[model samples]
Target: AQSVTQLDSQVPVFEEAPVELRCNYSSSVSVYLFWYVQYPNQGLQLLLKYLSGSTLVKGINGFEAEFNKSQTSFHLRKPSVHISDTAEYFCAVSAAGNKLTFGGGTRVLVKP
Candidate 1:
């Protein structure tokens, strides 16, 4: 079995500021890590993923995450953020073809 933990429920940052959303997972078997963003009143979109290979993976919208196998963590980061980046971010994990286990979610609030 696998589970995800998002340490923060909400993160507030000023526009153009840097931010990092924490995400950790626990599983006995190998799993894939993913970061998804959902804008207000919109569906979730894939931000980045770590299926295999390099521990450092980059994704859309200048987002990147490092997969630490030993730590069992995949934290998403961005050099700078925009007001439009305000949304709910979810961290998910899946083993093979199994269903995904998602975190509680982190809501990013970008202010002017």
Candidate 2:
């Protein structure tokens, strides 16, 4: 079984500033991790994922995440944020052939 937790419930950042969204997971078996973003009044969009090789994974919109086995974490980061980046982010984990487990979600508020 696998479970995901988002360390922060909300993150406030200024435009052009860097932002990091912390995510941790617990699992006994091999797992796949994913980050998703949900814009206001919109469905979730895939931001990044870590399924196999390479500790660093890059996603759309200039976002990236590094998967750490020792820490059991997959934290997302963006060098610079924009007002359009304001949204809810979710961390998810899934063991092979198992259903995905999602975190509560963290809301990112970008200030102008």
Candidate 3:
């Protein structure tokens, strides 16, 4: 299957703590990576991506990940998080369709 998989659908953490949501994908010929975050009642915003080069890629809001070609995985990580970080995060892939094939989704709850 040409789809990305998010292992954790939800992660709860207190404010100023660290968190990580697992993500994996089926190997592909060519792949473009992306992570979008939907905060509260907001739409999805691009967090980061690994289009090419450099296994490690950084994105907005203190987030980053490494594109592991061998493992076919790209997991998001944040050293320290804030309450405002609470939101629904989606890992997506686009191999052919203009539309993105999103993972189930993961909700990051950063409580005070």
**lDDT (10s digit) by residue, model 2, range 45-92:** 999889999999999999999999999999999999999999999999
lDDT over C-alpha atoms for residue 79 of model 2: 100
TM-score of 1: 0.97
Q: What is the C-alpha RMSD of each candidate to the true structure, in Å?
A: 0.7, 0.7, 1.5
Positional deviation of residue 63's Cα in model 3 after best superposition, in angstroms? 0.6
Q: Candidate 3's residue-wise lDDT over 2-108, tens digit each?
A: 78899987899988888888888874457888899998878889999888899989998899988887888889999999988989999998765355778999999
Candidate 1 segments exceeding 4 Å error: none
Residue runs of model 3 more than 4 Å from their true location after superposition: 96-99
> Which residue pairs in model 1 clash with each other?
none
lDDT of 1: 0.95
Candidates ranked by TM-score, best first?
2, 1, 3
Extract clashing residue pairs from model 2.
Answer: none
**What does the lDDT read for residue 66 in candidate 3?**
85
lDDT of each: 0.95, 0.95, 0.86
